[model samples]
Target: MSTDAVLVRVRALWEGLAAVPVSFSSATGVSVVVSPRALICPPGWMGVVALQGEAIVTAPSSGAAVAIRAAVARLSADGLVDPDLLGRALPLAEVLGPAALAYVDGDGFRPVSAGSLAVERLAVEDSELRQLLMVAGDQDAAESGLDEITSPAFVIRDGGKVIAAAGYRVWPSRTAHLCVLTAPDRRGQGLARVAGSAAVAHALEGGLLAQWRARASESRRVALALGFRELGAQLSVRLS
Candidate 1:
């Protein structure tokens, strides 16, 4: 995509997310706060909790505006979404995606030397080769899916197999939506931290925010280990 095209797409995305208002009351009398601007969700997914930093928004799947307001009122006068209470509000709520706590910090990001990990940049030109290395039995298969990307990807090799991977989905070019996958057998070996550092370093180097929206419980360890900070979790779901 051209620079102008990227700028246009990013601007439209930001505007869409900003249009949604923050609310807490759902028609179900649940208290929650939501970003009215948050537009990311799956089809038929009525309920959602949009989160960014301290900013939050909640909308019941039922599309009840009153529920959103009431939920917020139940939470507090300020009406901020508290992730801990989200489950109690909608415990059975089918998660539309990997419901995760969002963590991000730039205090320790630096250019990573490949080291003994043999980290390499996986570019779009090698999509065919990348697919061959994307093994489902690799352990982190559940989380390793390259749906799309704007930045060059990163990976670490062990023996001859790809043990870990890192990359970002660029939106607005300001925040890099980070992605990572490590073979379950190779996780504790610090391959993820090492490969992730390279990806993050490149993100910061390009003047982008290294956004770490981690989902897996163990993912926090990798993010924090790589010098990222906990920002909070963003929750969303597709109402059954």
Candidate 2:
């Protein structure tokens, strides 16, 4: 299959999940209101379900329409939904497909300085940044709806222009996942690492554990460098 075709399928799946209305919390000090209307799931084995708000989902609800809602409610009441909320409730065995959690070891990773780049937290005021991220890659093009929700983000700027960005859709559990992008012109400068570190420190300050869904090789390298270990893998079913 062509690369574009693969990306299209991936985007569709992620958008579908993100569209689900489910509240979530993370150990990275990120909280969001993941209304079904504003969900943006990430594609591939990341199993990223972009939600808004600070709620947890435990068990699938009785009705299909409200199953995720029920899950979050159940998890929240049990108090198992705090700090690494998703990790505690959604085990890889249950949430991911076979081989979804597979990854290679990433050694020789190194941390970067968080302050080397000019970073700014994005808010509703930073619509341009959102727009830029919305089209950062073909995958993002498939999930364009991500622009509708305003999550906390950090941008690396060069001479008043954004060169890279990293953001988290916080959940109640004090953990947040890292979503980063570096502009084509700024790849080698370690802008992603810098912005990512800033995001991690932000999460740590909030008593959250920062997590990210990365490609096997990329994840191994970045996570190891940032002190993150393999949690599990999330698999995707290609539509054809």
Clashes of each: 30, 40
Each candidate structure's TM-score, on Cα atoms with residue i matched to residue i, is: 0.69, 0.49
Candidate 2 residue-wise lDDT, 8-109, digit = tens: 333343344444533333563222233333323223222233222222222222232243333344453222222245444343323332211111112212
Q: Candidate 1 lDDT, tens digit per residue, 1-240?
A: 333343343333433543454332235333333433345453434333333322334454345445555445556322233444544443334664334433333545544556656878878447532553465354444355443557777877766666677877775547777777776566677776777787788777776766666667677777777766554344455433
Model 1 misplaced stretches (Cα beyond 4 Å): 1-37, 46-54, 58-62, 76-84, 87-93, 96-106, 110-114, 124-134, 137-142
Per-model root-mean-square deviation over C-alphas: 6.9, 13.8
lDDT against the true structure, each candidate: 0.54, 0.45
Clashes in candidate 1: how many? 30
